[model samples]
Target: MSKKILLSWLFMAILCLPVFAQIQEPVKFKTEWKSVSADEVEIVFTGKMEKGWHVYSTDLPEGGPISATFNTDKLEGAEVVGKLKPAGKEIDKMDPIFGMQVRFFEGTATFVQKIKLKGGKYEVSGYLQYGACNDENCLPPTNVEFSFKGEAAGKQTAEEVVATTEDLALADTASVDLVPLRIGEDTAAGEAADYWKPVIKELSSFGENVNNESHSWIYIFFAGFVGGLLALFTPCVWPIIPMTVSFFLKRTKDKRKGIRDAWTYGASIVVIYVTLGLAITLIFGASALNDLSTSAVFNILFFLMLVVFAASFFGAFEITLPSKWSNAVDSKAEQTTGLLSIFLMAFTLSLVSFSCTGPIIGFLLVEVSTSESIVAPAIGMLGFAIALALPFTLFALFPSWLKSMPKSGGWMNVIKVTLGFLELAFALKFLSVADLAYGWRLLDRETFLALWIVIFALLGMYLLGKIKFPHDDDDTKVSVPRFFMALASLAFAVYMVPGLWGAPLKAVSAFAPPMQTQDFNLYKNEVHAKFNDFDAGMEYARQQGKPVMIDFTGYGCVNCRKMELAVWTDPTVSKLLNEDYVLITLYVDEKTKLPEPVKVMENGTERTLRTVGDKWSYLQRSKFGANAQPFYVLLDNEGMPLNKSYSYDEDIQKYVEFLQTGLKNYKR
Candidate 1:
């Protein structure tokens, strides 16, 4: 029950944790050599061992440590021309831990090598890599550096031959040199290479595409919280609280009854959201949810769905249940038929608060779909319920506290206006989808920056009473939140102003367009780029020596935004994108107009391509049989799929595995 006791138990549990009786040692590489015959120097890679564990046999099909690899230093007089043969025997059978026979080892395994010597001495260097695993966990294979001396025949007596060790050679375990996205480059002028080049390199190698399947619950819970927060801020919801509490007091004139109803209302909110979350989880199983997250079609649909919600946020219109449904819910609430009325009251609360909570709910639901955890949506709803229900319970406990919150006034309108700006800011994510779908590239890097600048600038002006909406209440002075908001908006707008001219805007780069597309000045300094265009990126994917990593991304994809924040920023994974693979970022919801003759069918719906997004959407839905951004398709140099396509999520490990599998598959 106590923290200390719990921690002690946890530590003890870890200490006695059932293990596969594996050995683990700080990966160390040592060197040794011997004469196999007259003219050959044989290198013996005796990877030192740590007690209690064994390195896995490299010949693992189902599970085991990775194979130990040996490479030779570019030696002048010596060359390695034979395959590495380890001194071990293969044993495959059903094991207790592994349902299938898994490759494993005990103590140390030696990889024997024979190198023919020509005339002189030379140093050969490379790495020996193999994963070591206990019954509980597997440490990823890492290369330990080892080297050996090759001498001309008769140069040294057999007695002179001695074993030696060397410092660990850096193994390419998730090794990616992330050059930040930049302009111009030359390895020759090392001192002043285009700074942006390094930056681009970094951006290109944005690390581990998350799998998110496991953390579905976290996303769902977060969505619920966002919904509850939005519900709290709504004009209608905020005003009703005091009125409802007053009604409860006046109706019964009993403080206890008033408290009871307030608690009931809050509990009702929690029940409603939790039920909704549970219902969704029940309807969609984990595997289905995984499909939706990775499915390109679902992604496009989600992107479009967000656009619809954004439109609603911008006063386009309201999407609601039937009028009769609301009336029925209201009628039930008014009936006062026992505690049932409270439940009805909660239902009515949801209906009435729909205008405010609708977007948030939509956003939350879309997010939960990716989690693939049955409870994720429910968890999200729980978070939302807590945020919404907290105020009611807290306020009822201290009625006097109601007086402290500013009386509902023009400030409420200020809140709405501020939310409107956020709505617009989020709207661009949808447009970005269309931008990427079609090849127009209309909403390029700098353009995205400008729109953000304008949106925030307008928000700043509105805060200063320079702008008003149709529903705005005329107010001469800004309130506490409004003033702070205005300052934030103004400063943020100012921060982006330079981006239009070509600033890297690292502060906001994750959310902004790729640096290659920005037109800017400092921080991301560049000598106007001569980089190839989007078409070239695709061609490069096909022509390059390495494979292509096709990123089906959209501007308005919320999960795509999340993926950037959660996954791509990981340093270990980002380097792979920047270096080994050619990245083709395709936007599926581009809004730019097509030149001509762009017609297509998507989901059996016939359409003409007026915008770039249309074509891209069509391509994804039709050609690729996918409709998701954050969809990754690994392809060989010839543009054929090396492995099955994978979708995005919060699990970086699975994503890394997918990438690793693709590379391994191709190498085989």
Candidate 2:
């Protein structure tokens, strides 16, 4: 009975884990008002936050979290005596999420507002707004409303207490309910417009027919598999393959037993790497992974780390774990028996081959962690491990294949050196992100293109034996395979030469700096969005009777630039967007401040949109339930989606079909 009870408890715990992860509210509040004197009253708002979560102080600067504020709608027969002030233990420090200095409060917070009451009955009601965040995620700004009704410096008779409906001035609108404002509606009485409507439910039906989740996972897996295949050619991993297999074969007299052990060894590799991926996700969380990948400080660190790895691959030095660690793992494998021994052996290989595989794994994580999927890192590692482990099991099953395998030679070092060049070139991309974010202008388009051109050209020269590295063999000659690789590299370098003069290199647009950064430009043909404001664009589309194409993009989004350069540049797409549809490009990362902040009620929480980017971002989330960039949706004049939305696809024909579908729906 006890065992059954334990099993039931474990099952319920597993089910509850997901429910806990979905909880977004971390702070709770209560409010009270007290009479301080015959003519004075104090309103106190107290908040208790969850552990490790904090609310930003009332004095944070613009561009950070929304500072705490007291909003008032009605304060009849009373005037605020002083500013709303906070009484709590406040913390001031630099915040990594906003990349600036901020002040916040944790645990408990108290805010007091003093009001002087006129000599009559009075009423006061309003809401308090603030933003909260933890290390991993930031919640939308939230509001807590308060109301007080009392009489001050007056003794009312029984007849006076029995007042008419007009004398009992109640709130016109409920605190929780919002007055919906239609698009292009006039407000003669000065009612605020409801900009963020709950359009997500209506938009769901339009996109229900389209699904890209499985395709995205497959793509990431294939990329990691290719990286694993490349690592197999490195000198460190290739030579060890034979030696590790031989050890497994000699350990057991029975060939079947040896093959089974090899299978276990391969499985162990997968488990180790996948666990590492899971550890990363569990430690930093999905939201933090996105933040870390795009952070300027993280990019700079990644840039420096990649440069060091590239130098190691160039034979400047070796990057490896301590000898004692590998020795200890190897010793454990020899001492242990059965499955444990196999896992230890696999671990030993992982430690020993770190110098070759570490860079590949690091680069793969950096690329995939930008995605919103929490399991992306683990899925990528799973694919990589499977590819890396395939040969061991295959060779064990067919020993004759080992004799046919190519002998390790100077060619292995050649592949490593080529990878070094690629790493060196890719390292600049991270630095470019940081440069663009900080407006440093250090690696502009022309300068970035010049460096890439030189790197690929030098790589081509190295492949043709025109240059020598520290580990290169003196007798290295241009073989057929090497010759073709050199040809391709030289061609790629020539292709990018046009980019230095402002030509968009569509093939490398995903990696190269944007064309706007280039000083010189010869390319004149490019598609431009008609409007950046959502309401203005929708109004124009309504007047023209054209469908609306809203392009949700960002400055730092790599795939958005890829689609723009690759598909939007096509004549057909350009013409369709320019003529048949009203194009609206909303940049979610744009930092320009709005003329005046707008109050929006989204997901039952009030959010303050203080910047242009914040307004667009709120529109995307409240309207479509998506926050990723390069999101394209076609809507009618009423702002209802006409067709399935599109995201990050570079196929020009499919994009054309998407636009046509929306146009067809609109005409009907």
Candidate 3:
């Protein structure tokens, strides 16, 4: 009887053991509210997790870990302005169980949400659902209820209130600061008085799109391939092709071994170039590369570097690596056997041809480094190396083919001189970028167009044999290819002439600075927005009974300019943007500083919003969860989205349809 009683007790203890483990709470929550404006209040939720425990962020992907979610009990009197933002540092790690990346907060975490009050005061009740985990175990999902009272604050005198309300109605909180109105203002002078008010737009996230990143990689790769083809024609590289292949063919007894050795040499060249690219990526990192691409100092340095390269191409000097470096590699090739010798031979070729290939490689690297992808440099180098290596391997396999190839002559000098002029023209582009970014106004649109016109005209004259550099042949007659190139250059020069007098010159718009940089203008593209501030544009839209089109753009954004010139310039799209919709262009790269800095919690981290650009960037990220430029969003007067957002697509018909759809939605 005693043994049976003891067995029953043990069974009961086993059942209760699981229940005892569930009793402890590993995380605690606290909530509070702060007033931002008369109509908007910010609700902050802070979570404190026990030691060795963590709570997942709201943005974590599903099927990996449970994320924290927030919901309001009632949506009648108040509405959430944007997504719930994390207010503390987050730890991102790969989850062993789920086989994916997960972001979680350890220790303490804070989240914030903006709530806009429609009218009268009420209690805003909400519940946060979250899951906590530790190294050993994960607790079951839990919910914590939270509530905060909302009240309109910052009420002013009747005169102040009237002025403040009017200003607020016309101001976008994202990019502009609100200015208090003065009492006893003249009604006739109201338009002038309104200029002083600050514009505001709610801040959001500015993350880069994944698809755009992939597209950038493709663009860089193509650019590098073209650069390599151009490099192959330069005086330094062109002369070596026949000699390198012949050396390999004569050195080996067996034809098969010669072909294999030549192939190995080409592969070695690719490895060397790709390794150089990898070294650059490892040294600078993605973020630093981006910064370097845009930095004024770096741009200026590149301008100088290209200028030096141009002079070298013009025969002022030869830009070559150390002779000893090439000799050392050449000696190794002479001594070593098999693949090692072939690789050293290829290394010698690279070193000897650096005068021509170095500038091209440098330019390509600078261009590719701006892309968001870490492997962009490597991909670009791969493309270039393939183009550079193809000739050597192919020539080796068919030594007879060398007889059909153009003999190295004065034609190589002509190619070098042409590249010199081209390099000079491209160098101006980097200088222009620096000028525009720093607001120096040194390279204005008119000046830039004038310089380009001269450069191309000179190039045309040079191609026509009217102008001669140091190494040009005395032949007066131009070849058919050279004549056509001269004609093309002259045509391009003539096209740019009209741009000085304010022509759009849409073909080269991506390379040129903004039209706003032009001091004089005759042809107006009509793409400029009526209002750049969101609230001001929306107010005008409401009064005119039109929908709002928000253009998220940037001064530094190349694709934004491309879209403007290609798609927005279309008559149908232009007409809709001008008449049917209230266009608001928010420049995310605007350099204007905010009158006062604002520090706010974003994605669980505190960041200082110190400029107009930062505010708009934050607004875009927080409100729509988008951070890329050339992003467009259409909305009704009450701030509701009218249709899906648009990105860097240039299909005019699609853009027109997007506008029409938004207009149709707004009407409904």
Candidate 4:
């Protein structure tokens, strides 16, 4: 009797083991669309979403998913009537805190794009790019080019919309513009457009769609601004700002001529910049744009390069080329005194401006590289060149205005010193890049913030006449510009001080501090909800039967702050969050540490786990192939990787779309 009982108990125990392993299931995500009319297209997306798996919003990471965007482009004789809105059917979701009352289905989600075509037949085609995540991990984002030929609709019905999606045909939006590419002398600035044509075409051929929504347009705008700022300090440009005015004044003996020359200089700069942008597009095309901007080596190199520029600004070194070259260019300009002379003048300006402009140029290369658009870097460079070339161009065009300009003595040095502070602060970012890539974590958020505090504070003091430098001529009285600069630096310091106490500091949250380091924050829109442990959060996600969102963040990550403020605050964004996820913020810079003594092998060294950030960073590098902040992931309740992970973006709408897709995958 005892032996029989034992055998029966053993069988029951074995039965329970399989039940425990039932915590997760593998899920696949697939999307399809149907056109209801030339003006209205319905998206019928299906998620082979597995049990206990979930994806996230389009707003999840800035670039993780393509925003479920609908557009009506160039309707020859047509006008876009309206925007695409979601009134769709979805998979069923089971959750307590999030996604509890949501109606979702594991197999399909339907979205409608309503467009009122105005009186003409046009080819209507667009792309559908979404970031999908399953139970364990999120997948790298993929997009589809969807297209259709529909006539202006006279009428429509719900049933017709549903039927069209089920039987959609291949889209005709597969016209790819491939610029041919050629490898030439390394010294060449870039390859010709013909060189990249084949590459762009080939990538476009991979799938019939071209959707690269990961990069935010704001970044491009910012690139323009930074480029302008860098150009302002270049010697080639700055000295000429006044000299060019004098030259035109001497030649025409009219203030107006100088102004015209200055204007010409500015115009030439713009032309140069725009051409550079075109060249970049011609060389790399669209495919390389995405990788160019977010590289660690690029950032580090840029930072070091900036340091060199800063040193030059401090008069540590003279960045001039051989006198022979300058003389040669000058001689050529004298020989050809028309546009070529202007061009020669510009050439001289460029050579002279190298010291001041080099750092900015380097920054352009690094930041522009992050863009997925072939023209991004060039466009960015163009913006800078224009800014640098502006003063001379405008002053030459109106030479009389040059008299209003401040004398360039002590003020110039002061400007250089102020910029040096910025240089130092920015250098840490590059070092942080290296640290993150190599698993150093030496310049993590708190440390970074601390460094900025010091650099800026010193700048403020220096501006206030409390400090002196090697080039000082004894007069330390503060000018208004210098005062303002100092004040701005101090204000920045004040802004970051709150972060050390655990504030999110949303404005620059992406780049300032990691969320993990934040003592108090509310990423979740739900009121009064407190989450203090990772396991608890995961359990809640499991019980709610939704996916867990693990946010690996840190203090001093400028991009992170920008993302949180710019994206997470949107209304469509917040509502979706409350409905779909259990948010877990892991601050890679948090000072918290493992409770007991723990030693782990990292980068070939067995080191004792030091702080909270150490553990999280170790996990991030070991698992996710990253060391940057604002990293996001969607996992099943039981901790399986879902789809490919996404990085970050600055757009709120796109982020919202990312989450919606993640939810669809989770339900499946």
Candidate 5:
């Protein structure tokens, strides 16, 4: 009897061991539902594995690892269609323990299944059976349950239906019919339209291009600092530094008080500039400023403003504030005491130096406003103020250092004239943006390049004393610094001359108009895509029994053009793209409008889709979870992704391998 009782306890312990092991499994499962159409839904299952553990794929061979399997409970009006599809990177290796090749997924994996629905809403209950293993141990097969419910179709008003239909018709003309698959009236029309809305906030989070707000702030700060340094060399600002510091030192017999007052004056300058930056940000708001940065009207305005600034620098006219303002501030400085006197003095200097510093400040603000950060302008102003104030504070601290500083003279006027030429060249960049957006054809690639070449050539001649401006001294001999500036200007001009006939000119690609705008061609590569539309490219791929390569780009995208010239121009990459795949180039900046306007909801916000660019931009965001340009994805004829997507990488071999890998996967 004792032996039998011991055996019974052992048996019970053996049975409970499996249950305890199942509870310790490291993989977790989750399910989500997406409406594909009225009759179909996409069920996405994600498996998250703990560190150092992995789960086997469904296609693993027999006697290898335990493959993941999905089984559904009885459904009221739904049936599974096709097989489960894997949607993440997979690893294949020869396992010594199993003595066979095996495929598994580590970290996270997404598997999708299509389900056909009859009607109404339904809860799809399912259980996923899978096994996980680490380097040291393997767990037995375990089951986890999940359920998700979604509506088969959203209710759409008659106007919405009509608008969607007309939009589809317009899209069809562009060979990009975006109609949701449904019989008769699309029951998923509202759902489809909602999916296409601009996901601006989400794109920065989950999309491939993460927000670099901090990085942008750093760049803006440095740019402002450089601009401030340039402003200090101007005739108006440079001469005042010595005079202002001498006034403070000579007026105060106490050296400590003189230094303290000078530092206060510098601090006051910083405060004033930073306050202006804050005012601009508060008035416009960050989001509005971001939009304004991309607006055609604002670009044109910036262009005109820069041109005016250039003219001022060229001695066309003085850009000055009212004299009364500076005089009042000057009087206040004389009447006040302590820090207040220094603050008033700093304000007076700012007003007096406006003719020189105003253009620099305006250009800096215009550049900083383009950054997508709320505090970017403030940070930029702080940098500029710090640079502008450093010299005055240091000279006051060590009065003898002022003797080492270069005396203001005719060279200051030369600096201003050189800056004038640079301003004129940069102003055209803003004009190019407006011209491209509005399709004005006023400044094409060749025309823009010609203007730049002429401007820089003339600048070179002026620097070498061959050309003279109104404010230039009568000296004909070029200084050492002027000679170097002339050489740089001439070299830059010579470099840009090739760009007129289709040279990439990558150094200035960001500023120059796109190469497509050039009529004549000499450096053209032979990798042109046969189709620039999605549906047409896919259809061609299907007919030819090849995979599809989708290039999500933009007309204004500098990186896209760079990749085309730098990487895609390679013979290996070009052949693979042109022969092995049906290439589709979707320009997300195409501004042509649709036949009818369609409104869509995104994260509770309503957005109206009106242009061709909007439709392609929406497609890229919705389908691939990305919004940045120069995005590349490989797809089979069925629109299923073949492999991992790519972004702005300029490696030729990597791109060739990406294409080859997609082709291999498609053939398999």
Candidate 6:
């Protein structure tokens, strides 16, 4: 009877083992902030695990158990400079549950995130998400919230703490007189006003769509189509159109059958190009290509590639595939029948005409890749294919139309050489991006304009038959078409001359180095922001009893510059901003550190303001719920919205009205 009773108790204990494990928390976390430099701080998270229990590290592969992750729920005054780093005695071994190698800490784990403060004071708040496991059981992912605040690095705290009389008496004997700083005062009344407070709820009714939608894909497609049209005029492609059509007409006695074959051939061309685009996307992946598009190495490589293509177009040498490859493709086309044979023939054309079309296609693909859309490459190719293939099918359907087409001659070479010069000019733009990123300053705005001017002038001369390339015919007289093109080129060169002296030259602002880079400029008839600090600007506006216009912009914003040049330069708009409103321009990308971090509760979440930019960005987001740059808001002295906000619209009249409405509202 005693043995049976003991066995029953053992069974119950075995069943209750997992229940006991569930009731006990295995890991405890403690977070601390360590000032690493005058402008940097490190948030250290230390995790203590119970014996035989472990927690996973970050960056484990997918399809495995959850890995540790640190999520910043609120970041205001400081920027996270680097990734979270883990340190401890980690056990990296394969786990049967995940069937993969996993890393975890057994006794203790330390994670650190280094942050750069825009100002001396900063507040950071986030949660650590981790999963703990043991030999027989696994714990679900858990979150531990952390909040930290610190002053400027190396700033000793002067905070006074009250203590009991006995504790105070235990201090070292030093004769000192302590004086009270303030007594029986209303501290709340003396506290500084918060400029970033949420506006009245009625202001929400005036909100506009803050989303900056992109329509670049449509532009990219049309650009590709234009490129295809240009490629069709090249020497290699123009001559082949008639010959290919003639062969198709002669091969089949029935004209309808011949036309059908031509259509099939054109479709094959599109398939070939579209497949090439899909291959590029699949090989590189969208995320990687997006990153690569902005990388310095990618920009430099594209610059060199364009230069090489330009040289080839200048008649330095032909860029062609090996003869054997085309020969082999031609042989297969002859052997095959029906659509297969037509596809092979189209493949042959692609290979043979690559010398002429290769540069255009390469350049098209390069530009399209920068759009960062996964399907952009393929869409661009589709447009190019339709434009290229249209001529072949149309000519075959109407054989008589072939005679009206312009004969391939010196004009074709002129087209090619013109493209060469344009390519050379555009290559500089790519180099400029890399130069700015690395602070090389080798190719400044003036230098770039000079090169473009010289190149375009030379191109104009070439069009006038005064300049000759290697492939040009010895013709002294220029065609009427060439004369007009030359005039346009010279006119464009003349237009850019003013830009050298720091003219906004709104036309080329997107490509040119910013006006700030120019060393010499005479154009000063522009509007300037009255203040950059929110608090200072708001207080001054209140004293002046004027409306406030907050311009949320960025250092690298292209549209912001365009708006300033196009709309802000208008006399009416400038007058209102200068006289009727106090303008505050906040650069969201500013890197200046703040003197001290300011803490505030925003939307029921704590936010730390460590930099000037952070304070402005937080204001824009919390109050306006907008983060995109070139954001404009009109407010009264009390921080209430005066009118609807504006964005990248450059309509001078509309902008004038926007300002007038706000000024009128402020007066009311």
Q: lDDT of each structure? A: 0.59, 0.76, 0.71, 0.53, 0.71, 0.73
lDDT of 1 by residue, 1-668 (tens): 99999999999999965332111233344667776655667777665555434555545543223455565435556667587776765333333112123454455567766676666666665555555543222333344545555566565665426667553422221222222221222212332222112121222233332233444455556657876777687775788777776666666777898789888888888999889878876877754665564443454566676666655654557667677887998887787765788778778878877777777777777656655457777788899888988887788888898889667776665665576677667656545444543435666778888889999998899898898776677757767777888999999999988777765555665456454444444442221111222334544554466776666655534455445555555554566666667766656545454555343332233234444444444333332343435566676654355565655555667666666777776677
Ten-residue stretch with the least lDDT total in model 4:
165-174
Candidate 2 segments whose C-alpha is farther than 4 A from its true place: 1-220, 250-253, 278-298, 331-337, 365-378, 432-441, 444-446, 494-570, 583-642, 645-653, 665-668
Candidate 1: deviation at residue 401, Å? Answer: 2.4
Where does model 6 exceed 4 Å of error?
1-207, 210-215, 436-440, 514-516, 533-547, 554-576, 579-581, 587-599, 606-615, 636-643, 648-668
Q: Model 2 has how many clashing residue pairs?
A: 0
Compared with the true structure, the alpha-carbon lDDT of candidate 4 equals: 0.53
Which residue runs of candidate 3 sit more than 4 Å off their true CA positions?
1-215, 436-440, 527-566, 575-645, 651-668
Which pairs of residues collide in model 5? none
Superior by TM-score: candidate 2 or candidate 5? 2
The segments of candidate 1 whose C-alpha lies over 4 angstroms from its true place after superposition are: 1-227, 250-254, 285-311, 314-319, 368-372, 516-668
- Candidate 5 residue 552 C-alpha distance from true site, Å: 7.5
- Badly placed stretches (over 4 Å) of model 5 are 1-215, 526-562, 566-646, 649-668
Alpha carbon deviation, residue 412, candidate 2 (Å): 1.1
Expressed as tens digits, the lDDT of each residue in 94-146 for candidate 6 is 44223245788878988877878776566677666666665433443445566
Model 5 poorest 10 in a row by lDDT: 164-173
* Per-model TM against the reference: 0.49, 0.67, 0.60, 0.50, 0.57, 0.68
Predicted candidate 4 versus true structure: per-residue lDDT over 280-394, tens digit per residue: 6687665444333334565567678778767766678766677888789888988987677877777776666666666666656656665555666666766677667666666
Pairwise TM-score winner, candidates 4 and 6: 6
RMSD of each predicted structure? 21.4, 8.5, 17.8, 26.0, 19.9, 17.4
Q: Please give the distance, in angstroms, between residue 127's alpha carbon in candidate 5 and its true position after superposition.
A: 28
lDDT of 2: 0.76
| Model 1 poorest 10 in a row by lDDT | 195-204
